[model samples]
Target: MKLLSLLVAVALGERTLRPRGRNWVLGVGEQGPAARPPARLPAPTLSAPAVSAFADPAGALLAGLRRLLRGDPTPRCEMSRFVPLPAPASWARSLSPEASCPRALDGEWLMVSVSGRDLSLSSLLRKPAELQPEPVLITMATAVLTVLTHTPAPRIRLGQDAVLDLSFAYAPPTPEPAASLAPGPPPFGLEWRRQHLGKGHLLLAATPGLHGQVPAAQEGAVAFATWDDEPWGPWTGNGTFWLPAVRPFQEGTYLATVHLPYLQGQVALQLTVHKPPDVSLTPAPLVWATPGEAPPELLCLVSHFYPPEGLEVEWELQGGPEDGFQKATGEKWLSALHHHSDGSVSLSAHFRAAPVTTKHHGARYACRVRHQSLPTSGRRASVTVEVAGLSGPSLEDGVGLFLSAFLLLGLIRVLSGLVTDCDPQEKVTASTPPTF
Candidate 1:
């Protein structure tokens, strides 16, 4: 009795077991579709299972059972292609069951022709119907770039250290019809190109941030610097590059290109280099001296500028017009300017002018600075020589001294006359004559 129960349990377990599209048996053994041998003589032929029948599990099981009871029919799978839209009329008309389809392109039409002996369209339609292709599936790919800087215009001072940052990021390609399906990471690279400035116009240094890689910088010419990123599958991340410094060049607009893998993408970067002049005005003696003394010198200092070849300095009496302003000439305005090794300039101007009076007081002697780097208004520095007050005796003190001097002279003369006349008037009869 126990053995009988064990056999029944085994049977139940076998019946419950189900495998994916594989052959099975009930209380017996079964052969897979691939392992069956062909029949040599005439025999009863069974109908094959329809591909569409798989959509209904119960119906597929019933059909599979019926086919197994009789002689099994050969199963076959077939694929068909439809010509994409915009194709020639002949091409569309020529589509056949054996024709192969090319890979579908984005924004292009594609036809999927599905048919097989096992999958009966007529049965599903409940009547004979024409075959048609389904909608096309398009795949989209993109690459995005962003630039960040420490300065407003990403400006770099000539011969001075500066750094610019660039960030490159991208996402994986998305397959249409099934947007959730993302492609595995594709290989990517980076190349830098210059548009405006010629090579060697300025020295440039490139360094990649963490997660950034450059595989071919030296292989390419000076105009292009190449980089490659380590593969990170279908994930969104970014890399950065830094431009530490640049040598002096003509002040103008410059364009840098980033050769990206994006289709129909515009990826060019821009920067500006300016050499605005820094000016200062000074007088040898900041204040005016007495009229008898020699005139003081006016000095102007121009510093921290670039491309000094065409630099010019003009002197103005206050804020005067350019025509009214005098350009620094010969010895009157001596320039001790020299171009520095670092592509910068430093210079001084000297001018001699008379002492400041009330007319010239508070009037600004301006040094207008001009250069190719400066804007239309230009840059300027000014100095004004002020009048100095006299430090001497006042009118009240002079009058007191004169009066004392005159009084001393008169007393001395009177004393001298009295001493000389004393002996001649020595007669004693003066007192008796007075009494009579």
Candidate 2:
């Protein structure tokens, strides 16, 4: 109990305090509404001049003015940041305008970023809110995307989504007492990136804006958390994603990467996808075969499997009530592999079963399969076999005897008729009378 409590306490950081009702503002020239510079915003909104979230607000404004000199729509620029409204000066400090962008915890936090920045723009403009310049292109280079591992880690289907939770509420930034008069850096999260998933990184957890969000909330004090004393920089968090519906061709190995500026630590992460097969047994072929003929055989059809290799099928037999199932080795042989258009594979297996016998009546035969995608015990199916061995000579054997006797009698009668024909044809006495 103590250990669990301690761990929780450590993970939770300082709970940020915020001013209620008012939203943060972004703009050029701090005056009128912009004149009121609060330490933090409850939930900030853009005023007018605060539309831009660039490091060089004044310079960006100057560039916008030049574009307006020629055309209303400014020259195209990339979306560099989605820094929360009323962004603290610390967010811009030591951070390059081109290096990365500020993203929210929730993957669906688009509305939050827009609303906050717009509120700040209104405030910064002070007068009638005018001249709103938005980013033309947003690169995913610094965008945090969804991170996915192999299914069956928790187990999911190929087309099923692997979703995650990465959401949180945080306090706005506050101006520091230092000479720079710059507000502290906004909270940031740790994220993971992959090779094929575009330039987006995977959101991890907690904010490191001022103090670590988790540690702050858990310990009830962000100031005294372990981050303060730790050699690595502040904590970061709020990341999530779900992969697009995957297909069979998409199954393979992948590499994942995460960037940590402070620690320079890298994780060797990889993912592999596998699809299991469906197995079935057929005993109908052996059901009607004569005992003296060919050996009884069972067929095991394996289909819809992946990688198209390392598949094996075995047959087992249980003869009589007292006998246990035994492997019918040397009798199992696999047929050629057949590839499916859907990127799956199939195989046929023939197992020569034991000869049918009266003692083996009511026996059971089973087909077991082994494959990379299957569990340790693998998959199997079975069917009961009933065999009453050949009893007496068949009807064909009796018919053979009857035909033999009839053929012998017919041969004797034909020989006697031949003898009578030879005597009559000679007629020696009739020849003598004619001579006298």
Candidate 3:
């Protein structure tokens, strides 16, 4: 218990002293390194000009005019410095103005360069200095732009409507060096340039303006670009802009590019439009079986489909004692259907009976297919079930029957010979028989 109390006391002490040590660490308190004395700036010298009342009055007037002209205290001119930022994926920096406009971070920040000359007269009072202008350059103001584009591919069906999305938000420039003082880069604007969506196979309906008002006529290119004249350095704020709804009539890849005219920076994205699958059902062949054999399972083929490439096939049986042959629901009756390499699916239903009886002899088996293309009545195909087996004597049984009949006829003939002609040679002696 004593050790625990001691640990608690130590923790409290640390907590209490931690705040006071911050000043020492920052070099602000006496506990820290001694602070360096501030540098001394030269003081401007002022002395009454020597003016003799008897001197030339005209010279005094000229001197007074000169002093009044320089009285505004040389205007401070500072040079503006621009730091080349890392180029974005689409924009390039350090290019000649004619080559391409430099790009700023999308909705993030824009650094501006300013050039000015400092005209402080304090130097004139200290010593005779060269009459050259002092120019200072610095990156003073930063403009921020927010860029947003449709994520992923804007996927749609060939005939479906797709809206291309590209938008940006421009935040007010950072307050630094008075807004009126900093001369930033030329106004930056974003506009849609071109589309490679086939040869007019895709049609665009309208190009919307900044106020969500569409233009009078449909345009091939859409621009969200607008100029800002607030002297805030040509940065315009556009909340959101949508590309005209486009209907793709072809199935292929398409691309669109949005550009920042001032920076020559562009953002491009690719869109994919797919064709709906063509679905078809093949006629299921008739199922046949023997009297005591299992019926062959029936198959209905759904072919020529794409994109999804697979479909569901159902089996419905009709014509049994209950006025309908109920489809088998057990797992044993159905086989899992898989798509072929060629993107075709074939599903089959197995029909079985412990001992196939005549009750299921004429049942009709139909396969109903389900796919995007085929509608209600057109997806079904039926095949009749037939039980046919040959009923005829076997070769071994026929041979045995023929042999038995022949043996019986032979026996009858032998018996008749013994009864009527037993003694061909002694048959003529009728009197001898009588005497015996």
Candidate 4:
């Protein structure tokens, strides 16, 4: 019975584990068909923070999920992606936050909230119809999400709470142009004349509102003659010039130019010349006295016609005779005497007597008179005087007489004292004794 039980156990075990033609089963009784290969799992997607250092894991995941469910297309999840959103309808109100708020749009809040949701990349790209392809918006939204999630946000200071106030500074503008200095009329017109009173006399005058200023001692501004084109006066002070006495030069019209300092233009005047009054000598033959032991007298008479009041006259002896006598011990000759008065002049010669005599026979003398009115025109006369006799005895004659008288007196005294004594001294003495 034990042998039979062993055989049956062996057969059951063989049935449980059967091997195919060349393959035999050892440990397990029978093996089903070879185990099929295990299925391959897909690679795990990276979290937002793991993929980009700047992304926020929770926010990025939420946004990606929201984008996937809303049939929105997923954008490049890289931090480098940037996009711009549509212009807000309330842009004007946003610009001025201090002012009153304006009305809101219908889907403005929904659109902004949807932009914050997370989305799966594949599911979000499946429906391109429901999702608008706005590359700029997607890029901008991704960039903003990335910065908000991974970077520390900066705080904005608004209104009066801000620390520093800013403004622009500028300078004031310049003024416009204007005129300067007061205006007036030009200088007054001037006029003048030249009169020839004498060789050295001149006169000038002007119309109203014109006067004469003294010329400089040095050469003043050059003056031109009205008639001729020549330059005149830069005259010295000695040259006589009178403004009130302006008259003509000769028998013709005279014109002159006068220059005053600080004057704008030359002064011109016209004058008519009139014939001057005639002057003559009363005693036609001007007689002169001869020079003698005593000075001789010279006399001359002059007469003037239509003589002006306060007419001044002067007399002078121009020259004397060519061979008039001269003394060895005194001046060669005496000058002719001169006499003058209101309108007439008398030329007189007076001899200053000296011890010496003079020979003045047939000596000629001249008398010259000058009138104040007619300075250039004057009268001159000459006369001849005869000087008689020769020179007197000299001092030598008196000396010779004195010497002769002295010699005669000496001879008489000598003869009286001497007597004719016969020769000896003894005989002279005896005669005197016998008489006594």
Error of 4 at 319 (Å): 11
TM-score of 2: 0.41
lDDT digits (tens) for residues 92-155 of candidate 2: 2232232343332212111111112111010011111123246522111111211112121223
Identify the runs in model 4 with alpha carbons over 4 angstroms from their true place. 1-264, 268-296, 301-358, 368-379, 388-436
lDDT of each: 0.38, 0.38, 0.36, 0.25
1-436: candidate 1 lDDT, tens digit per residue? 0110000001211112122233321121123212333222213222221112111111322232333333324322111121222212221222222243322222221111111222211001010122335441212112122221112134566744433333222332223343444343332333333445445222232322213333343212232223333343322222233443465643333333222222111122344554677888776334454443433677788887876667777776642122334543323555666777767778887766543444444455777878878886789887654544433333555687898899999999999988977754565544456544
lDDT of 3 by residue, 1-436 (tens): 0110000001101111001111100011122112222111111121222111111111211222123224423211111112323333232222223443333222222211111121111000011112323441211122233233432246554444555554333333323444555553333433333355444322222222222322232334333444344454424333123444334322243322222333222233355553333333233455556666666644444443434443556666687444665764322354555555543334454434333556656777666666554455446677766666433444565788899999999999999988786775566776465553
Q: What's each prediction's TM-score? A: 0.40, 0.41, 0.31, 0.19
Model 2 gets an lDDT of 0.38
Order candidates by lDDT, high to low.
2, 1, 3, 4
TM-score of predicted model 4?
0.19
lDDT tens per residue, model 4, 1-436: 0110000001111112112232211111122112222111111221212110111111322333333334424222211111122212221112223233222111111001111122211100000113345442221011111111110111111111111110110110112121231222111212222334533222232221234343332111122212111122111111111222222222122222222211111111222222223333323243323344433444444443222233333333222332443321222232332322322223332222232224344434444445544456565555543343323333465577788788888877677556543446767667675543
- Candidate 1 residues lying further than 4 Å off, grouped into runs, are 1-153, 159-161, 165-185, 195-197, 200-239, 249-266, 275-278, 285-294, 307-314, 318-337, 352-358, 361-364, 370-380, 386-436
| Most accurate candidate by TM-score | 2
- Clashing residue pairs in candidate 1, if any? 50-118, 51-118, 51-119
Q: Is candidate 1 or candidate 2 better by TM-score?
A: 2
